[model samples]
Target chain A: MSLVDLSKQVALGIDIGGTNTKFGLVNHRGEILVKGSIPTDEFETPEEFIDALYEKIQPMADEYCEGKEFEGIGVGAPNANYYRGTIEQAPNLPWKGVINFADLMTEKFGKPCKMTNDANAAALGEMMYGAARGMKDFIMITLGTGVGSGIIAGGHLIYGHDGFAGELGHTIVKPGGRKHWSTGSEGSLEAYASATGISITAKKMRAEFPESVLNQYPEEEIDSKTVFECAKQGDPTAIEVFRYTGQKLGEALANFVMFSSPEAILLFGGVIKAGDFILKPAKLHMERNLLPIFRNKVKLVFSELDEADAAILGASALVWEK
Target chain B: MSLVDLSKQVALGIDIGGTNTKFGLVNHRGEILVKGSIPTDEFETPEEFIDALYEKIQPMADEYCEGKEFEGIGVGAPNANYYRGTIEQAPNLPWKGVINFADLMTEKFGKPCKMTNDANAAALGEMMYGAARGMKDFIMITLGTGVGSGIIAGGHLIYGHDGFAGELGHTIVKPGGRKHWSTGSEGSLEAYASATGISITAKKMRAEFPESVLNQYPEEEIDSKTVFECAKQGDPTAIEVFRYTGQKLGEALANFVMFSSPEAILLFGGVIKAGDFILKPAKLHMERNLLPIFRNKVKLVFSELDEADAAILGASALVWEK
Candidate 1:
């Protein structure tokens, strides 16, 4: 009954982003043995990207997995479909139409491959090795370039009818307010609560309050980081920006809580680094808006997964599902 | 091979409302063989209510299930908890605090019993016998005294952590717009789209436009039905009320669809009787608010279940689950 011997299985994890594609070999304990990345825009077609990926990954796979058999491959990408194993019309990606990423990866690596959107992979990562361990129902909200959500109900990720459920970022928080990036919908959660949204909020606040310290920074330099820097220096306008972002996020989180009623909502990625500035207002507003039944029952916490290794671990976790 | 001989099994369905409590003996096919109701306010205590319910239901159970063994009992009440078999601080119920209703009913009838909130029961009923049959992911919205919702994801009703999931009615549709009845939240979906809310909208429109035909009806007489009549007669203000209500509902529904990505959203209860007056505007607004991927994928339709029998059948579906 030696459990140590059984824990030797490993998987290859791939995270395909707009600018770069990161790939790594991950063990059962969520530890990455080796990882590397390539410029995604360097390739014109999905086939070309796959060829470059194979050329780069095969050497790492051979070196890292010399004594162990690679169990499978798991991929996290933009607009990925878990059920169909395809990436369809992803706005950020160069490829058009549907790309059968899993089939191509499986054919190249000679192992089963599973794929899902990045946020969902983060959700799985949290469940497997981070904040959501041993929890059945929770939502993971990633506030990076855009706001993305992965909803887990009854301990299962909800892929819905077309493998595209958990699109909470697109849900409207303020109707007819701010226009969204891709959807063009007014006042979506992404329009106000994302990293880009935070920067936009900072820009708006700078214009509104001419006397504020944020006015010193050029429009291009006034990003989420600059807002944080200004807030640390006790700038009123910069502080208000985080508060506004947090309130919008908190209200949307309340709506999401009412929808699925998850036990906890784990906040992930860049903006969460704002810490109490964002979290305090977000938690306050979420609690304030909740119905009596739901109030005080849900936990709003930052994701515990390591920022650098989370994607690979998350993608590798998908192999365990298989 | 003679399945007809074994098809005589029946279950008791109970729907506990603020004013009245309805009970029925139902078969697997969702047929109510015998049904009756009692004034819920007649009993000051839950024990008294249970006694009266037993008295009325036992006779029906014995008569209808003469040769066939009575299977179980299912109760649908406001603020019911499926996991705990209790009702906690229900606003409309006479009994306050927590009541182990399912255990009480099971103890009283000497049969297995199951209970859930009315909306969740309605969702189960729809999956088993109504518009949601053969569909794994869909939402059921009941627009009666208040707006309530039942969310089905991956073929199971989402009970969340506290057995109080799918409270879509309470989700904010118009921030800081209209105040809700119970929760007192401003601009919740229930505040603008429920039967009560629709009437309130009509009253507000009448006040805004003094020359409108809706001003002819006494304020007290302006119910959903009266609003419908007024709109049919080409009352611009009345028509505007339905349009406003539908827009709010459709926007909220679009948010819900994005969250869960359901195959359809089934509208149930009284307000939906307005038909195209509400449906057309709702459909338009929902499509308008939806993200590009979700725009045409979701179907918005009225529940096909018979209005009178739906509650009982929905309650009975809980037993089938047990």
Candidate 2:
């Protein structure tokens, strides 16, 4: 393809994780034409990481945008500030301080750049091209290493006064029940419903049920994925872990439903991979807890995007939306 | 005043309580020019009650509107539907079924009419004339016979797909703790933080401490007001009742702060009259529970409107907003 023709259309989508940095050149429709990744933890500073990412992505952008328009870059990162375009005190990221990520991307790529917390990006992506397409009011919850959320009300993402609205994961699901390791707050939903939560459940279950199938694996090896695998094989202990997690999640979602009354709540991330095992229990508890007006009104579904491409597409949707 | 001139400047605001109905003609500045009331329980039907209200309010509206403008009529009632203008299955109201209240008001008064549940009206009132003026995002919580909430996001009340969003009072504050007498849901905030909840707390405290000053009053007479009186006199048990109520309320508000990240949370209704007794503990617990990003950022305050004029003014705000 000719360089002039390649410059006619496309955007750069980037997802920064604690372990990896994934980037892609995507079309307006969210199709990734080219992609690459780098080890994020290897970088000593955000500037070094950006330099490495630019080196890897430039050739792909050059190849894809030779005859197309070069749209802006969109980034999804932990603790990203959409309004300020900085990543602030992200516990998981190797970078220790506030990083002007969007500005750096704009400077390096010679195009406009925007950034939002990963969950918000996922919500925007779903609104544009995933299950939430055409829906004005919905909540996107990412249940990965930790729980994160983005709320859409009246067709707009609710970024309250400090650009930190929609932190549903921290809302108490079981007040005074379990203490969150980091915040030390009792009964935060993240303590009982996230991937880490599943592992914690496994540990507790292991101590209580010594003869269970989960006992076959070393305690450290029994993560959410392992539990899902065991549940698929009909292990009672593993199944119980998901049941407890779903019950907590469902009850929390019911509270959320009553609070915001969203049209739907879309679940995304690693823990959701348990599929029907988690969904069935969640639906049951949510319906059981909801008031008559909200009962059965909210649709709870897993994300529709392919896991590998979801982050890339989610980031790219920001550019398309603008 | 001339009839045409009266028709150009005023609106009628009506508040329908279970025992009595208060009605008034209010000006654009939220001043009540004239007011009247009718016993609600004496009426056999919603139609009859509405008819009696119209009969009482018509004379005052006519007398004051002789040379003024009558913009519209606005009603605040229990279980009101903003979209359909009906009151549905309000447990406290004398009316047994759905009441087409706004439509009936429009037909009887010969003016455009709008209706919303009392809490929502309070939120709109605050937005238009009270503490929330010029604020786009805030939560108005009415701490009355029962807890109620109205959420404003991006400068608009969030009436969800079913016109019944912002039911924060029903959100679970303590999972599996207290059962709501009406909904049968365990741990709902209304079960702990409302005026009735405070009375309930007083009863428990009275039993636990036989020497409590609250025991002087018969169980039936130990309402929130009596408890407040006792608390002001430094009754330990009475003060403890308010402390616990404030703790529950503060914890729930903290969760809400995380979910929506509002700039402030404005409290209204009877229980708020306790002032620093409730505000102190609520602020302490709310700040303690908040995540680092949200900590100390939210302003928690009581509504600034006068109690007598608030309901009427709240209803009148609907007409102006519309």
lDDT tens digits, residues B1-322, model 1? Answer: 6565536878788999999998889888888889999999888889889999989888878788989868898889998998999988887888989998888888899998888999999999998888998999999999997999999988888999778899999999988878787788888999998889998888888999998888887878999999999899988888899999999999998899888889999999999988888999999999999888888899888898998888889999998873
Error of 2 at B204 (Å): 1.1
lDDT of 2 by residue, A1-322 (tens): 6454432568888999999989888876667889989999999988889899888988887777876787788898988888899999999899888888889888887899988888888898888778998887889999998899988887787877677888888887776778999989888899988999899999899789888888889868989999998999998999999999999999999888887788899999999999988999999999988888789789998888888988888888778764
Q: How well is candidate 1 docked (DockQ)?
A: 0.77
> How many backbone overlaps does candidate 1 show?
0
Candidate 2 docks at the CAPRI level of medium
User: After superposing candidate 1, which stretches have Cα over 4 Å from the reference?
Assistant: A1-6, A59-69, B1-9, B66-69
Model 2 chain A weakest 10-residue run by lDDT: A1-10
> B278, model 2: CA deviation in Å?
1.8
Cα lDDT for residue A47, model 1?
88
Model 2, position A235: C-alpha lDDT score: 89
